[model samples]
Target: MLDLRDVTLVGESIGGVLALTVASALPDRVKAVVASNPYDYDRRYADGVRRGNVFANIAIGSYAIPIFGAINAALENRLFLGWVLRGGFYDKRNLPRDLLAEFDRVGRRRGFRYVERKTFAGWRSWNKARALYKNVKAPVTFVYGDHDWSKPA
Candidate 1:
C-alpha cells in the first residue's frame, strides 16, 4: 500500500501518548509526530502530581472557584511562577503572563460549584490513562524537560 502522506500529529501531556498509539495502530497513516511534556504510559514512569501540587488539585477540585479568590488562590502570579519554574516546559518563555490573569478572570465566572465538580471529575478520571499508556504501539518522539516529572507530591 502507498504510505499515507503528510499525516501530522501533535500532543501534550497524556494526549502525547494517544498520538503515539494512533501512529502505531496505523503506521502508514502517520508521517510525523510532535509531543510536549508527554506522559509516560508505564506505571513506573515518574514525575506524577507531586505532594505540593496537591493544593492545586484540592483547590480546583474541592474549593472550586468561589469567586475572585480562586484566582489569587490557584493561579496567582506567584503560583504561576512556581509552576513555570517547576513545570519543566522547554519553552516556558513562550507562555504569556497575561494569559494567567485572563484564565483567572474567566475561571472566576464559572463559580465554585462548577469548578469543584469539574475538578472532582478530572482527578477521578485520570486513572483511565494508566490503561492507555500500557498499549501505545506507535513510533513516538517525546519532548520534555527534566522538571516535567516532579517528585511525587
Candidate 2:
C-alpha cells in the first residue's frame, strides 16, 4: 500500500471526481483537495440537465468496444476537437488554436480513444465516488466555470 500522508490533491473535470474519491477514502492522510468542474452526473439529472440516462450509458459503453470505438477514433480528429472545446468554454472565440492542435495530436495516438471511452464509463460510476465525496472529512474546494456544459437548468 502507498503511504499518502499530508497529500493535497488537485484535479479538474473528471479528475476532480478522482481527487474527491481519494480524499474521501483517505481522509486522515489527505491534507486538502481542489477541484474544478467536477463531473457530478446525479446532480446534473437532479437539476434537470437531462443528458445522462440509460441510453446514453449504452452509447458511451459502446465506445469501449473495439469495433464500435473505431467511430469515436475517427470523429475525435482536429475538426471536431475545436467544436467540442468551443462548446465547453464560455468564450468560443478565445480558444487557443495551439492547444487544440496539441489535443488533436494526443487524441490520435493509438489506444487513447479506448482509454477515453473507459474514462467515460467511469463517469457513469460517479455515484460511487459521490458517496465517498459526501463522506469526506478533509478540506476540499470546488471551482466552476460560468458556462460549464454540465450546468443544471
Candidate 3:
C-alpha cells in the first residue's frame, strides 16, 4: 500500500467495476472512483458491452483471427481473434494500427488455451467482489451512455 497513489480510479466500462474492487479493497487509500458503463457485477453480470473496436478484440476477434489470441475461457479454446469496429467504427482505413498491434501482442501471448482459461475464469468467478460492492464506503462517480453501457465516466 506504500505505493498507493491518491489518483482518481477512473475505470472505463468493466474496468470501472475492477476499479471499484480496488478502491473498496483499499478504502482508506482511494480518494474516489469514476465508473463509466460500469456494472455491479457482484449482483448482476455485465458481460454485454460489445461495442467499439474493443469488443472485436475481446469477443469476435479470437475465432475470426484464429491465429490471433482469442480465449473462450469456458470452453478452453482459442480462435482467430477477429476484430469488429463497433458503433459505426468499422470503416476501413480509419482503424488504428496501434490497436491492431496491441491485439497482436495480446494474441501472441496466449495462443488460445491461455486466453480461454483466464477469460472464463473471470466469468465463472469474482464473488468476493460482490460482497465488497454492497459495503463500499468510498465516494463513487458513475456514468453510462443512454444507448451504450461502456461510456467513460
For each candidate, how many residue pairs have backbone atoms clashing (under 3 Å)? 5, 0, 13
1 or 3, greater by TM-score: 3
Error of 3 at 124 (Å): 3.8
lDDT at 107, model 1: 47
Global lDDT of each candidate: 0.50, 0.68, 0.53
State the lDDT at 62 in candidate 1.
Answer: 32
Sorted by TM-score (best first), the order is 2, 3, 1
Residue pairs with colliding backbones in model 1 are: 24-138, 47-149, 50-152, 50-153, 51-153
| Candidate 2 residue pairs in backbone clash | none
The CA lDDT at 144 in model 2 is: 79
Candidate 3 regions exceeding 4 Å error are: 1-7, 39-46, 49-95, 110-116, 126-131, 149-153
Looking at model 1, report the run of 10 residues with the lowest lDDT sum: 42-51
RMSD of each: 6.9, 4.8, 6.7
Residue 140 accuracy (lDDT) in model 2: 88
Q: How far out, in Å, is residue 11 in model 3?
A: 1.9
lDDT computed for candidate 3: 0.53
